[model samples]
Target: MSANKKNFQVPYTGVTKIQVGKKLGTSRLYIQTPSETYKFKFQFIKLEQVESSIRSFLPSSVLIESGQLD
Candidate 1:
């Protein structure tokens, strides 16, 4: 049932206890995933904005999007 959006992935280490419900973030926003039952803090990623940029899913032909790839 895992979608595995593949937007961002962070490897889990021993210290990070994997559980079903946990929080992950660093100020901006925190997202909770249904399955962390063996994974730790994988990695912090702003996937939607970041991924969209990479995939060129923007409407502006000029791609004037700034602050991305920061």
Candidate 2:
């Protein structure tokens, strides 16, 4: 499953790092910020572990202070 779409919003400043994840065959969205972590089970099989794997492929998609969409 090659998910080529990344939808999120990272605050301007005072932000550290952002993370998102979702399970297979599901549209749930999980977010993890510096202050807290949240789970959003939009619909379908929005399991935690599967979403964890989706998040597993994130680091490489991370961007710096260059406004790069990655």
Best by TM-score: 2
The models' CA-based lDDT, in order, is: 0.32, 0.46
Model 2: lDDT to the true structure: 0.46
Tell me the spans in candidate 1 whose CA falls farther than 4 Å from its real position: 1-45, 57-70
Error of 1 at 35 (Å): 32
Candidate 2 lDDT tens digits, 42-62: 464545554455557656555
Pairs that collide in candidate 2 are 22-51
Cα error, candidate 1, residue 65 (Å)? 22
1-70 in candidate 1: lDDT tens per residue?
Answer: 2477655553322123211222444212222234543222324545344334333632333222222121
Task: Give the RMSD in angstroms, all C-alphas superposed, for model 1.
Answer: 13.8
What are the runs in model 2 whose C-alpha is more than 4 Å off?
Answer: 1-21, 44-70
